[model samples]
Target: MTIAETAAGVEQRRRLVTAIPGPASQALMDRKAAAVAGGVGTTLPVFAVRAGGGIVVDADGNHLIDLGSGIAVTTVGNSAPRVVAAVQAQVADFTHTCFMITPYESYVAVAEALNRLTPGDHAKRTALFNSGAEAVENAVKIARSFTGRPAVVVFDHAYHGRTNLTMAMTAKNMPYKNGFGPFAPEVYRAPLSYPFRDGGLDGAEAARRAIELISVQVGATNLAAMVIEPIQGEGGFVEPAPGFLSTLAAWCRESGVVFVADEVQTGFARTGDLFACEHEGVVPDLIATAKGIAGGLPLSAVTGRAEIMDAPHVGGLGGTYGGNPLACVAALAAIETIEADGLVERARQIEQRMKSRLEDLARSDPRIGDVRGRGAMLAVELVVPGTTQPDAVLTRAVAAAAHRAGVIVLTCGTDGNVLRFLPPLSISDELIDDALDVLAETFRTTTVTS
Candidate 1:
């Protein structure tokens, strides 16, 4: 057997034996269309059979480079050895005892790990959940209970989730909140510090603008929480100007509003720091995390100050599968992999390499308007060649071209004009180079028609 077939690894290179979707994947897509909900969309129609390291093997044996990391879920790489081993052992013993019913050790262990890892050294407690949306929902509930207030504030371009209350908090409209509204009440939207678009306002000044709006409309006396993604994820990896987060967080602390950091995408080792809030030395009163938490398993958490987290009544929190044993064990293993492998620094290395390449692309390509993000989570905003107008059509065309060429890239932003890259830290440098080469070529080929 070759090195790829043996214990060391799966094939690390991208190889396209057939077209992008091929026959096998197309067949699955056909079946899915007939059975699955039409409301659920697919980014790349190709179905993955096996995935590891930086490669995702589709049904037709095409090994594609993974730049999205399952939308920032598989941070330790797919089928990470430790996660697999732990899941296997846990499954043999038990899958779900329902932590609310007959609590399990893995569940407690996972909670302890979250409380220790999340930003802030304050006395903290954690409540587990199954997805990022659940964590955010619970965080809001906890904040409301603690403050005995009814109003909440969120920033522009923020994406919390799809549930009733979160949809009201999310800023985007079309795909995430078009027809699904008639959303929850008392959620207010504030301005965000978009440095690229904010002219040259410094962080503190920009934050002042948002604070003024919030105080005027949703006064601190009535506000329960202020929820925001440290680096806005699905809305575009919009890293706020320097000091923006710190200024806002301080205001919340003094005003008694629970500052909630939705690090669902920027948590773990994806953004250089274990938590993106650490980048600004901002300590949130509550943090909702999910993506990249369990090496692909579905596990999320709300970690926060003990008094705030414990404000809800005895039975006010928890779900039937909130802290499922299998997910908890997978989380423990994933956390160990992150610390032992030094993935935090690895993310910084990836940021340096990717930012260099993307910046070089921007220098030569006029359509590339901005290069932003940190660590493995970087993005480029595409604009009309001469102006700041969003070139969403060109963005979509280029992404399709990359998908065809065996590189998986995801697009985001309210205008759908930003291309974000979230590569697994386990990915090799060579693999990243190859993916960038494909991206460069895709831009070149698509720019001709644009």
Candidate 2:
């Protein structure tokens, strides 16, 4: 199907009738400043009226190429037909009955699907939640209950969530965690296998160092769980070196520490594989998933080994809207779309396209320090010429340029020096090439000096 036909039937081509964030969006921004809280930030002020395929139609009729995919949530596109139909049917039947109280069939179905789809062939169990943070918090609880331990281990550039405990687990400070402190205690941070910045340590050496630190500082016996993103998301799409994840999983197995894979941004065919952990054949003891789980609906889940998942008390694990009927149906539809549409393979195609273009760009731009990631989830880390010093300024400039030129790009990384690309799998090759053209021009015009 064509890109436009896929995304809500809007014309597939980018059309800029006015400047980015034209009059209508600017007026909305004014209203937002008056009504909305300041803490909640926006990447671009352009108000989205509609989105589908790979374009977000803004208030003033600007069709901007969507490379962010609403932060990797819309793997099947913003308005996948099946998800829309399922949500409509569920909404017509009922909106909320509080699954914790009444329960539902769709919820159970979602759990079953998650169990089957998540890595590993072993019998598994799943618990539903409203957000990635909630899933993570509950996963920690399950690990602690099962192991009788208090400490939770996370990596240096990890981003669990924004909740109290998850805030502690997350690594970044300014936006996500600054001043949000007195965060949950006993959350230990370990070194990650960041090849770009790890002083030339290979995957094995980095894993060895992390293991050594955890052994000395936190002691595996005291650790309840060691949570990591199979492919670190907000931390610049930093895919750990080869063997790092498997080695970590093996160590966790030996130590009885629950290996929790936070696949919030990398799951549901976004990372080529069904889950990022599958790339290394590492099956997590517990997997926290969200983002791409329910098309655009709010749903998250913790799927893991049966015994560990059952460790929580009968009543200790649920939320009022944990598995809202509407969200559950949406999740089921989204999963079906992924499987039926061959989105997993589509993600691989997107990766090859994006990596090829970015690598071509890198050959001429010294600031393009490294190009990394997998499937549709990819990134380029900017650096000072001839040095590994992060260049956040250049990153911001390029992102802003992309935005001005009617393309939506997102910036990430602990140092904020990386530009991430997460286009929808349903997006057409034509649209992707167009977005890359914008990126190429942005790089050409934006001065990057040594």
Candidate 3:
């Protein structure tokens, strides 16, 4: 449903609802069914008319707390004034010149911002793209060009993208990669240190095992790059143990393999740091960033050591809308807003609140096998009592309960037993408390056996 343009002086917290789907949203959905493709599936029933900092207004006129953060986009909040103004200004001037042909200031400005924001003190260069998948693919290409090798190493439960190369990089088989091969060649998978699942091995040990495999089977010298997610997003919000990242970084240094961190979901302060690599003090040879870079615009970037980035000859990298002025403007506004508004600190605040509340629930409930995450990107892993077997049934029930109670939550995990929380950093303390209360009530009241 199209928004009516909120009434003047209307408060942002109003939740007065005439109907959940309301008249307008249902009408729009019906039209959407015909106009839009059938590949997309929505998590919430109510259609959104408008969204701002931490709340979404449904076409039914109900106000709901935003917890999923648009699948980890809009981390700085939706419709940020700075982002809106920048986009408007750019649209008026010029939208596209194609950076490959005639470069624009906005593109270079964004690349500069990314260089400064990403980890590592070394000389860095950035190439902008339109999506995270594109960034991942380019990262592999750059790694190959730099190392003059063909083998790229990724981890199990990893999700790089939906493209051919990324499909090979991803671990899941049923939907993402299932019927989508013959995939790109020379991609190898390693085991990730999932402490909860991996038998009794510590973080460093997990990294060691993976290193040994590569050394024995593939031989690290032949590998071009090793790509990983600092905090795996689509594979489940899995935070690798303390020494895991550092160990991998050390291995890459010794082997001359480019260490690529796919920070597409964990970057831009979504995980409290400017980048998730900062959590372990591990600096990668390359980094791919997106999701929240432009507040909500389509922008992704590959930033890394200058020599490696430039290995691809001039004009080897770019797209028609690769770094469009409008998206670049949005990115500039987003970065400024993040710095000026202290969203990084805000992310820590959300993390503390989530940890305290969820840990308390874990202590009392056997179904809540684990509460894991860093910063505002957190999750609860559901499992059957006294066993590691995933409790997908309970996870689905609890999600449905939360929706009924007016809070939107999302489920993830290889087994679909993990409930991830990707709340906006700008969301209020009151909203956080309210959503946790709903979660607690859902857990307490829902019957697993039923």
> Largest TM-score belongs to which candidate?
2
- Who is ahead in lDDT, 1 or 3? 1
**TM-score per candidate, in order?**
0.98, 0.98, 0.95
TM-score of 1: 0.98
TM-score of 2: 0.98
Candidate 2 lDDT tens digits, 389-423: 99999999999999999999999999999999999
In model 3, residue pairs whose N, Cα or C atoms come closer than 3 Å (at least 3 residues apart or on different chains), thus clashing, are none
Lowest summed lDDT over 10 consecutive residues: which window, candidate 3?
1-10
Per-candidate count of clashing residue pairs (backbone under 3 Å): 0, 1, 0
Candidate 3 local lDDT, 25-122, one digit each (tens): 77878887888887666677678878876678788777777788898998988888888889998899987889888888999999999998888899
Model 1 residue runs over 4 Å out of place are: 1-9, 448-450
For residue 437, model 1's alpha carbon misses the true position, in angstroms, by 0.5
Ranking by TM-score: 2, 1, 3
Off by over 4 Å in 2: 1-6, 448-450
Residue 206 lDDT, candidate 2, scale 0-100: 89
**lDDT of model 3 at position 380:** 90
